[model samples]
Target: MTGKGGTGKTTVAAALALGLAAGGHRTLLVEVEGRQGIAELFGLGPLPYEERRVAGTADGGEVRALAVDPELALLEYLDMFYKLGAAGRALRKFGAIDFATTIAPGLRDVLLTGKVKEATTRTADRRRVYHAVVLDAPPTGRIGRFLNVTAETARLAKVGPIKTQSENVAALLRSPMTSVHVVTLLEEMPVQETVDAIGELNGLGIPIGKVVVNAGRPPLLTGTKVSQAELRRGLAAAGLPTDRATVSGLYAEAKAHLTRRELEESLRVELAELGQPMVELPLLPSGVDRAALDTLAAELLGTR
Candidate 1:
């Protein structure tokens, strides 16, 4: 899932993973950009490079989590292809890994994406290991270039394993098996970013998935034209001794809610015009915890 940062994209990604697992798909939830978001959302410690089964679903499928560190991924790549088993440490100690990850961000992104692609295609006993792979990818701001490994590698290497690996990664991203879901809030800036990201992803030939509106507030005051006087009267009829302060506060709060709800509806209409599937996650009263994540998972999968 890719979205503007702070749009709860990571949380939605975790919920989607759980939802897929619950639906009988052995899902792998991978976190890139060095954020332990999946672990934190699952109420577990940071995940290691190796995948670990973090949560089980209702259908007996499993959700395994991994945080792909570019440095570790680089070492794993070297060990796999070059048999640099011991020299990997030497390379890290010589600050080569740091230089590559920091000084060359495109290379870092390639390494990270390469690891995710590997997990997605990895199999055991001639069968697929993960039925689905969900990546809490980089924010929408960087996701375009991050997933465009072919273009990035073309600038770095004319020919080699790295270039070839990048081409493969790009192919996977553009393939039918991969879908990029863009998450956003029902606000101006986030919705704008989500729209722009969709366009960018389309231009790059990456398959687009759902545009999820996270933390969506329901339209509580629907199907009725409520006046301020009617709101005051309704509060009074509730048998509460209404002081001037309390009534004023109540009216203000209700008005604010109605305004926000209207704005959200407008944004929702805007998103609908894009002609992509849109998912709405209601705002959780108890905030995002394990139970809330499960609730959201149910909502995401349309089980609730």
Candidate 2:
């Protein structure tokens, strides 16, 4: 899942992992940003480089999370393909890994995404390890370049293991099984970015998945205008103050709510034009906690 920085893509990705893990399916949630956002969202301490089980479902399903560190991934890559082993650690001690990733940032992305690919395709006894894999990828602004691993690595290595690794990652990303879900809010800038990101993904032949509208609010007002007289009468009937100040305050609040509702509706219309399956997650007034995540997971699975 990917979106504008504050659109809660990580939260949505975590909820998705929980949703997919229902009914005895093991799902892997991967984050490459190195911010430990996943660990924070799950209310856990720092996650190690290795995959660790974070949550489990009542139906025997499980959710495992991995925060892919680029430097460690690079060392793993060295060990996997070149059998560098102790030599890789020695290079890290000399700061060579950091220098290499910094100099060739694209190589860093390769290492990060390569680890995701391994998790996606990894197997035990010829069976897939995870039933589903959800990557909390970079934001929409950098996502196009981030996921286009083939192009990024081509500039660094023309025909080597790096090139081959990037090609494989790119293939998995563009394949039918992979769908890039762009999350957005009911606002102008984020919606526009979502459109642009979807277009870029399309140009790159990456499958576009659902357009997630996060923190959506249901319209409260039944009409564009509320009747002040009716509101005053209702207030009086409810034994509340019916003074002008109270009535006018209520009216103004209703008007503001109507205006926001209209803006959200217009943005919804704009998003609908993209013709992708859209899912709107409700705004959690209490903020996101473990219980809120479970509610969101149920919403995603349409079980709530």
Candidate 3:
């Protein structure tokens, strides 16, 4: 439930899901956006509504992915609340569901939650199916509204099946086992967003399970008072065989790159002030895979 976007929220969710699966928990990875981000990250074809196995239990554990559609959840909600009968048929004929969902405020969030709730409790052939469900939820900013859908409806419908159902859903969201996490970068915007999100979620009684700051570079080469700029000028002195132009250019390039590194270090210092166990991931150009995810998940969960 990270309050920020582009802060590796999806990546953290995916890694956690796969890591749990690897540890032999039959895991379900649910994406609310229906965006292809999860599929693209996992190198799988885009998921359909139906639960489909994306990875085997042998290599990892049983891992399944699903993209929940709010509209379908709305239809289910309608059926549960009202026996449409003739009205349902007429609505179906004219595509009223589609139109209504499109215009209805907060309907998408309600539907999304409904779909996830359904998936979370599902059983397969009388067998306990998924042990854990990882939601690649909406960004931190929208998550409060998204999860508050049930409460919103309960307020609207003071009494009725809708209200009752909404209460039941809300109970699930507020459960102790229902943990919310945030993923962020060491940068200002993301760190600020994380702070804001935590405050909002705590106000709404959502437990902050963890705060993961991914793609953090460690202090690999440190404690050097030999400043890059000072070293640059000193190193700029030409070798016996070198000319001034070539030597100056070499130092200039090194200075620029090292300056960027120093800036990054400043950001990391700011991040340290947050007072949480920040999970630092290496700056991997290629995104997370099973191996990469394993490495990072280990770092995150303190297994490494």
Candidate 4:
């Protein structure tokens, strides 16, 4: 899924993976960045940059986790390219391929993409093992450029393994079976990125599925508050309490202060521009509990 950092993309991805796994799909949730979110959320700690079995779940179905490392992927790339025994040492003497690839901008993305492609093909005992791979991908800002690297590499290496690899990745991208969802909020920049990522991914022939709107308020105040001035005017006109009385009155004040009505309206307009239906998760309480995440999963899947 595409989204800005800290906009709940990783959280939503983890919840989705768990939900799918609980529903009896042999799912593998992959994290490209070194953020061990799936690990932490599931109470699994410091997962390796490769596939590992998930714990702390009630399901009997197969569930696995992977934290894809660009360093490892770059090594694998080198392994494919070099047959000489001295090549590894030579690369090490040159400050290693890790610095050249992982620290570099687009090369890092290429390595990460390669890791995902590897999981997509791996099978066991002549049987298809994994049913789905839910990637907790990079943020929406870099995703378009991320996918574009395949085409770029293909262009640079017009007639070899790079072109062949690009062809395969591009096929998987353009496949109807595979879908890219952008996890976002009913807010400003995240919503805008969702709109842009949907178009960019669609332009690259990626299958754009649902726009997952995360942690949205559920229409509490009701109708057109517009701004703080208008909201205060309306509240005063209604002759409600201007000062705190009961605990619930403070709750109302806090909600009114934080609520951004104009932001929500702008999101509606932006979402309309994109023309993709959003799967919205409700604004969870402080320190979101298990039931909250379960509710999120159900809401995301539209089962609630």
Q: Which candidate is the best by lDDT?
A: 2
What are the RMSD figures for all models against the true structure? Answer: 1.6, 1.2, 3.6, 4.8
- Candidate lDDT scores, in order, read 0.87, 0.91, 0.72, 0.73
lDDT of 2: 0.91
> Across residues 1-304, which tens digit of lDDT does each residue of candidate 2 receive?
9999899999999999999999999999999988999999888999999899999999999999999988889888888778997888999999999998889888999998889989989999999999999999999999999999989889889998899889999999999989899999999999999999999999999999999999998877767466899999899999999999999999999888888888899999999999999988999999898789888888876799
lDDT of 4 by residue, 1-304 (tens): 6688878887787667666766556778889888887778777678887778873246575568888877667767777787545777578568677677645566677677767777877789976577777888889988887877676675456686756776677677677757788888777878778877887888887788788877777665555335545545556778865443433465566566546766686787778778777777777777555676667768877767
Q: Supply candidate 3's per-residue lDDT for 16.
A: 77
Q: Which residue runs does candidate 4 get wrong by more than 4 Å?
A: 80-94, 102-104, 222-259, 288-290
**In terms of TM-score, how similar is model 2 to the real structure?**
0.97
lDDT of 3 at 240: 37
Residue 192 CA displacement from its true place in model 3, Å: 0.9
TM-score of 1: 0.94
lDDT of 1 by residue, 24-55 (tens): 77999899877788878878888888899988
- Look at candidate 3 and tell me the lDDT of residue 149: 69
Which 10 consecutive residues of model 3 have the lowest summed lDDT?
234-243
TM of each candidate vs. truth: 0.94, 0.97, 0.82, 0.81
Residue 155 C-alpha lDDT in model 4: 47
Angstrom error at residue 170, model 2? 0.9
Q: Which residue pairs show collisions in model 4?
A: none
